[model samples]
Target: MELINNLGLGFTTVLTFQNLTYSFFGVLLGTLIGVLPGLGPLVAIAVLLPFTFALDPVSSMIMLAGIFYGAQYGGSTTAILINLPGEASSIVTTLDGHEMAKQGHAGKALATAAIASFFAGCVATVIIGLFAPPLAKLAFQFGPAEYFSLMVCGLIVSVVLASGSLVKAFGMMVLGLLLGIIGTDSQTGLQRFTFGIPELADGLSVAAIAMGLFGLGEIIRNLESVKSGSMQVSKVTSLMPTRQDLKDIFQPMVRGTMLGSFLGVLPGGGALLASFAAYALEKKISATPEQFGKGAIAGVAAPEAANNAGAQTSFIPMLTLGIPSNPVMALMISALVIQGIEPGPAVISEHPELFWGIIASMWVGNLMLLVLNLPLVGLWVKLVSIPYKFLFPIVIIFACIGVYSMGNSAVAVATMAGFGVFGYILKKLECEAAPMILGFILGPMMEGHMQRALLIARGDVFTFFREPISAALLILAAVALGLVLLPSFQKTRSTALVDED
Candidate 1:
């Protein structure tokens, strides 16, 4: 009953003209970015982040969430048509999706991907409605020690989730924590790393750093790769799937949806992880596993559904506990902070409209993708052919104008430029930025809670273990780190090297 009422509030809030319009535009842009061969939602969202400053918190979050999930839907288009996975989560789809295209079942493959994604999205949204409130209530019970322990667990969990070397991921996280402490100390009012600049008093601008790293750094990286953007598509017979095709896909979709929803709430488990896990599970369970790499319908349907479901449920942690489950979630939290709203368990009770509105917008965005992506397939493919030379310059110009617009200061823009170079260097070093960004966002909060917890315990560090919740979280962190140190785990990491970034 409470869930229905909250959703009723959500639908009412999102049905407004302004909110609906922005949501539509956000998904549209997301689809466009997803269709491009090398472009992903992370880069696109980073570019669009600066523009969201003009929007209300509810609308900005709704739009950014739309972009992230919308990219998951759009990525399947290229994977089926041109053998390219625009988003990392879509990588599994290319295994059989492209084969389906080659076999002249392009329309069927695309339709299955779309319909499964929609179904999974509906399921995932309902899961959020049912589960988020209880989790938020649980989070409300956490004390300073518990919060600090959870933060430690979050950081540790990121290293596990990261695709690259665990050592490199941890190094990046430490760098992020250090960067997070650069501003004036909130409690002491003393400067830490301002280097005699008044603008540094508020710390580095989130917009500048995000735009520089994701927006500018991505452009530089893509330019180095330099590939022709033209796409080749198989002939489309019809968008409708046959009864047999639908039957073959239904169970896989259901399985993937359930699996993804469960994994998405876990720290560091997200769309990419869900997609890969679902694909592996489907292959393992299939009677004729040999058909998976061929044009099997289940191969196309399961991962698509899992990734979409994962994308929706990944919001659970960010919205409920104020801890980000992924870099994209971290970015969403940044949006809330810019709006003068501190995101945490209190958000559910204090700002019900903003909370529920974003949730309701998820279903709306999925419906829009189903309607827009089908007929617009040809249009998206054509748009992808536009040269990178034209795109990156516009992106650079947008970054400059947007960063400068943050405070109307040349200093802010320069900070972005510095981070752009730094981000490029990190990319060259094969270090993932996701952990770093997550660490940066969580670092300050962790320090505050840790200090408060210590002060309250009268400098007795054993107090963390005395608190059950904190003790469990810290134990989990220790176990995770311990597992990473094992020789077997190191060998597994070496053999299964995946790149989320």
Candidate 2:
């Protein structure tokens, strides 16, 4: 009954003219971003973060959330129609999706992806509404020690799950922690690493860093490898799937949704991991595993469902615990902070409208995506043919404009440029920027919590162990780190991350 009333309030908020319009535009732009290669939700959200300041918190969140999940819908379009993956999570879709296109079942593959995504998105939204409140309630029990320990656990989990060298990920995380402390000391009223720069007093702009690393850095890399050619788009004859197709995909979609929903709640697990894991599961279980790369419809259905489900449920931790599951959630946390709302357990109690409105908008947005993806299939395919040379300059200009708009600071622009080069270098070294971003976002909060806990305990370092919850969290962190260091686990991790390409 409480859930019903809350959902009623949510629909009322989302059904407003302004909020609906923003949601539509957000999903539309997200699909466009997904249809185009070399761009992702992180870059799009970062580029638009500054502009969202003008909107109300609820409206801004509604739109941004739309973009995140809507990308899942659009990514499959490129994966099916062409061999390219528009988003990292869509990479698995290309294996069977493109094969279906080659066999002249392009329309069937596209339909399967859309239907599976819509179903998973709808189910995941309900799951969020059902589970988030209890999680938030549970978070209310956390003390400073527990909070700090939880962050330690989260960071360790991110390191364990990160693709590539654990040492490199740890190094990047430490670097981010160092960068995060570059401003003034909150307690001492003195500077730490300002180096006499006035702008450093307020700390580095998250927008500037995010835009530079993801937007500008990606553009520069894409430009270097830009090919001059038009892509061949598969022609869509029928958008409708056969009755048998629906029956065949229903179980895979359900299984994928279940798997993704569980994984999405874990630290460092999101759509990319969920999609790959889902495809692997389906292939392993199938009686005719040989047909997996030969246009099996289950391949299109499962991963599409998993990715979309993972994308939506990834909000659980961010909204409830203030811990980000991925870089995109880190940005969402920044958005909440910018809106003067501290993200965590208090979000639901203090701002019910914002919480429920965003949840309701996910369902509405998925319906819109289902409506949009089918008819506009041709439009998306046509968008793929646009040359990268033309798009790269535009992306760079927008990134610069967005960063500069924050307080009109040239120092911020310069900061972005520096990070762009730094990001490119990290990419060249096969390092991921996600862990660094997470550390940067969490470092200050973790430091603050630890300080408060120590002060309360009369400077006793063992206070963390005295608290059962904190002790458990720290133990979990140690176990996670220990498991990742094992030779057998390392081999398994590498094998699981191997891409079809």
Candidate 3:
């Protein structure tokens, strides 16, 4: 009954003319970004952050969130049509999606991705409406000890969640946390890592680091790869999935939704991890495992569903706890802060309309994606043909503009350029930037909470393990760290290494 009332209220808030217009535009632009190579949602949202200053917070967030989720639908279009996964989450789709395209079933592949995304998005949004308030209430019970322990858990999880060497991920995360301390101290009136750069006093702009590491980083990598050849594009067909296709996808969709919805609530698990994990899990359990790399419909369905579900559910942590699980959500939290909205447990009670309205807008946005993706996929395909020469400059331009617009400072531009160079070096060394970005996003929160917990405990470090929740968090962190070091797990990884002939 409570869920139904919230949905009704959500609909009322989303039905407004202003929100509808922005939602539509958001999905459209998001699709455009996803179809283009080397531009992910992180860069998309970062590049667009400056423009949101002129809009209302709810409207801005609604649009940004739409773009974040909508990119999932758009990304698979390229993964199937061009064999280029527009976003990291869509990489799994390429195994089967592109093969299906080659067999003249491109339309079915795209249609399946779109429909499953819509279905999963709907389920996730409804779940959010039902669970968010209770979750918010639970969050209200967290004291500094709980929050600090949670931060420890998040930081430790970063090592396990990272793709490469655990040591590297931990090193990068520690570096990020140290970098986060560059500005004026929150608890004291002192400067730490400024090195006398006047702009450092204001701290590094999230926009600068994000745009540089993700946006300019992509440009640098693509520039190095400057390929001299092109491949044959697949011919698109009917956009409808057959009955058999639906039957094959039904179970995976359900499983993906359940898994992603739960994991999405975690502090560090975002759509990218959810999508990759779902793909891996589905492959492990399928009766026809060999069909996975050869255009299995479930391969297209499961991860696509998981990514979309995770994308939507990721809003829970940001809204209810003022903690962002990913860079994209971090941008949303920043937007809310800029609007003078302190996002926390009390947000639900204080700004019920904004809270419920954003929830409502998600459902509406899913509908908008369905309408937009079904008939307009061909247009998205056309974008794939856009020359790299014409495309990259625009991305670079938008990136520069967005960074500069933050406080109208030239320092931000220089910061972006410097980090772009740094990101390029990391790319050259084959170091993954996703973990770095994740570290950047989580670093400050983890630090503040750690100190708060220590302060509240009056120098007693053991208090974190005294509270049940905090102890549970600590135990989970310990187990995660242990598993990552286990010899058996390490052996399985080595056995899977590709052997060159």
Candidate 4:
């Protein structure tokens, strides 16, 4: 009864004219962004974060959430039509999806992707409604020690799950932690790494760093790799799936959704991991695995469902426990901080309207995406044909403007430029930036919690182990780190990550 009431209130909040309009605008822009290659939701959100200051928190959140999942819907369009994945999660879709396009079943493949995504999204929303409250309730029992241990577990899990060299990931995370502490010390008000720069007083801007690392960095990288020739887009003869196509896809979609929902709740597990895992599962279970990369409808359906489901369910940790499951969730936490709302157990009780409104808006946005994606398939196909040369400049311009607007200072823009160059160098070195961003976001909070916990325990070093919850989290972190060091697990990790190459 309470759940129903909360959902009702959420709908009431989201149904407002301003909220609905922004919701539409968000999904629309997200679809457009996804249709364009080399621009993901991270870049889009980072570039737009400064502009959200004018809107109310609820409207801003709704818009941002829409952009996050809406990209999933649009990404498959390009993957099927032009053999290019608009989002990283859609990379698996390019396998069988492009194969289907070449086989002249592009419309069928697109229809399967759209239908699976919609169904998975709706189910994931319900899962969030049911599971998030209990998780948030559990979070209320945690103290500073438990929070600190949980962060340790999260960082370890991120390291274990990151698709790169373990040493590089760990190094990046440590660097991020170092960067996170650059601002004035809260206790003594002494500058740590400012070097007498006035702009460093507030620490590095999250917007600047995010835009530089993801937006401009990606733009620069894409420029180097841009092909000179035009792409040949597949034609959509029809948009409806046959009855057999539906039958072939139903079971894979269900399995993918279930697997994706569970994985999505884990730290560092999001759409990219979910989609890859789902595709592998489907291939493993199929009687004729050879059909996987050769235009199998199941191949198209499973990964599409998983990525969309994972995208939505990844919000659970972020919303309930204030733990980010991925870099995008890190950005969402930044948004919450900007809104003066702390993300944790109290978010539901203190701001039920904002919490539920974001959830309700997702359902509304999914429906909007379903309507928008199918009829506009041709439009999206045309969008994929746009050259990177034309698209990147606009993104660079917006990213600079957004960073500049944050402080109206050239230093912020310069900071972004420096990070952009740094980001490109990191990319060239094969170091993943996601874990670094996650560490930067979590480091300060982890430090604060650890300090508070020790203060409460009177400098007792074993307080973390003395608390049962904290002990369990630390043990989990230790076990995950241990597993990563094992040779067998290293081989498995290499196999899983090789798909990205």
> Which candidate tops lDDT?
4
lDDT agreement with native, every candidate: 0.86, 0.90, 0.81, 0.90
* Candidate 3 per-residue C-alpha lDDT over 36-79 given as tens digits, one digit per residue, 9 for 90 to 100: 77898788898889899999887888788888988888888889
What local lDDT score does residue 250 receive in model 4, on the 0 to 100 scale?
Answer: 100
User: Each model's TM-score, in the order given?
Assistant: 0.95, 0.98, 0.95, 0.98
Q: Order the candidates by lDDT, highest first — what do you get? A: 4, 2, 1, 3
Off by over 4 Å in 2: 499-501
Q: Residue by residue across 1-501, what tens digits does model 1's lDDT show?
A: 888899999999899999999889889988887877556777667667768888888898888888988998888998888887878789999999999999999999999999999999999999998899999999989999999999999999888878787889999889889988988786777899899998888788767777777767777788898787455777778999999999999999999999889878776778888888888888889998999879999998999999999989999989999998877787788778878888789999999999999899998999999999999988877766688888778777877887787677788889888888888888899888878887888888898898889999999999899999999999999999999989999887776664222
Per residue, candidate 2 scores C-alpha lDDT tens digits across 70-146 of 88888999989989888989999999999999989999999999999999999999999999999999999999999
Model 4: residues with Cα > 4 Å off, grouped in runs: none
Which regions of candidate 3 deviate over 4 angstroms?
A: 228-231, 493-501
lDDT of model 4 at residue 117? 95
Model 2 RMSD vs true structure: 1.3
Q: For candidate 4, lDDT tens digit of each residue in 71-154?
A: 988899999999989888999999999999999999999999999999999999999999999999999999999999999999
